[model samples]
Target: MQTRVLKYFLTVAELNNITQAAERLHITQPTLSRQIMELEKELGVKLFDREKRQMHLNKAGVLFQQRAMTMITVLDQTKNELLAVNDQLSGTINIGMVESAVSDFMMRAVQKFQEKYPDVRFNIFDGDGDTLRERLDQGLCDLVALIQPIEAAKYNYFPLPVQEKWGLIMRKDDPLAKRKAIMAHDLYQLPLVVGRRNIVRDDITDTLKIDLNKLDWRVIINLPENAKQLVLSGKYYHFGIYGVYQKYHDERLAFVPFSPTKTTGHLLAWRKNVQLTPAVEKFIQFVADQTTHKKI
Candidate 1:
């Protein structure tokens, strides 16, 4: 399918109004409608559900929307990579980050990198490690900051300075909140919210020797923010690093470090076998220089 047609589909899918989508796309309404119908015919599936004046994505449309967006992003990045081959160190670096204390380190690197290469720019995407890895695999990200238990061994990485301390997000009024650290038995009686990454979960399980399934595993979350609203209910606890611990800013929530002091470091990684843009290569070297003493 043509990229222009895909853009038309995405525009309509987002606005859910043919006239508004056509206006935003700066195209005639009839032309937009014809393009949408032809796209559906080409794929042999109805992409949208029409209800009188409004249009919404059907199941097929929803799935296609994701693929369409990915295709567009890859196209844009490929163009940028080609343009970045020139002598000028100008290109956008798509950086994926997890919500860890190490993300702070990444921002610092961004600040320094920008100061040195004013022509370059960065697009930052935040998610859990797994989500970030998926984007990196799809060539959506140029570099990603990942915390410990990184299983993507195919990618080359350098350790970031500092490590993340494991902790619990607790309601301030809870009696356990008064403790300096959370013990194993403390978790046995409490309902917990945890990350979806199995490797990290295994580390926590082996370190604490607690069976998570035996406890209340009410929900699975990719980021700490999703658990914040649940934690507000005072019925569940969130396991996260000090980044989210200090980030919540809500007076009701208290951060309690895990007893025995579990910690994990972070690494800045890039996919293997992909041609690196000049800006991305320089930024990687800059971060490596800041994080390590090794000569580049």
Candidate 2:
């Protein structure tokens, strides 16, 4: 079968509605239906059972879909590899970055990589560590950078140049800002604004083990900027990695490192076992070199 026909079939299978699939593929429903009919005729097997307005995949169709999806994935990867081999580092790199890393580190890496290889393109998605990990597993991102331990065994990771530390960001006038270091118990007393439950939060929670009901936890915002704004109002305590709050540390905001006796946050990650393109490999090497040099 033609690749185009297989694509159409896959699209239809995904939506399970020819009309909807047609709209997605930007084709007429009649044309899509005719193509499917021709495909079934050539294969000598019924792929779908149409009942009024609804459609369901037949046994053969279900099996075919499994194989077809694998084929499509391989073909797409092969195409990307071929393009990369042709010295066209022009394809997109989908990256999922934690909010803290995006401000300085990720942007610097992307800028430096793009300058050296101007043809390379990028698409960045931001989220907490757990969300980033989920996206990486779902094949949505080529790489993810976050501040959390990677527990998955199927993936490999390289450490970035920076190590992160957890901190409490509050208004300059806040009484807690007077302390050189804040403790976990101190945080528990305040209305804390933290990221949603992710690896990072889990680690913190596991370490703290404080009663949720007793703590006056306020809103849980996703982006660091929003959390900073909330903390700047002098009513909430923003709890996140130091790097994320560092940018906004000014006369209005004060950031105090969480007491070492309390808890400390670290940065690490896991990535899918996909073949790294030349550009990706180079970027990885740069990160490795930076990390090693910093250690020295």
How high is the lDDT of residue 198 in model 2? 54
**What lDDT tens digits, residue by residue, belong to model 1 across residues 102-212?**
777788889878888888889999999899999999999999998887986789888887688887887899887899998777787677888889898788767877766
Query: For candidate 2, what is the lDDT?
Result: 0.73
**What TM-score would you give candidate 1 relative to the actual structure?**
0.94
Best by TM-score: 1
Every candidate's lDDT: 0.87, 0.73
TM-score of 2: 0.66
At residue 203, give the lDDT of candidate 2. 73
Please give the RMSD of candidate 1 to the true structure.
Answer: 2.0
Superposing all C-alpha atoms, what RMSD in Å does each candidate have to the true structure?
2.0, 6.3
Model 2, span 1-296: residue lDDT tens: 78899999999998889999999999999999999999999989999999876678999999999878767755674566567765566566667787664336777767877887887777788887667777777666677776656565766776666567777888888888899987667866788888875556767666666456566667876667766667877888887777776666567888788666333333434465567777666666665675677531
Which lDDT value does model 2 have at 280? 62
Cα RMSD for predicted model 2: 6.3
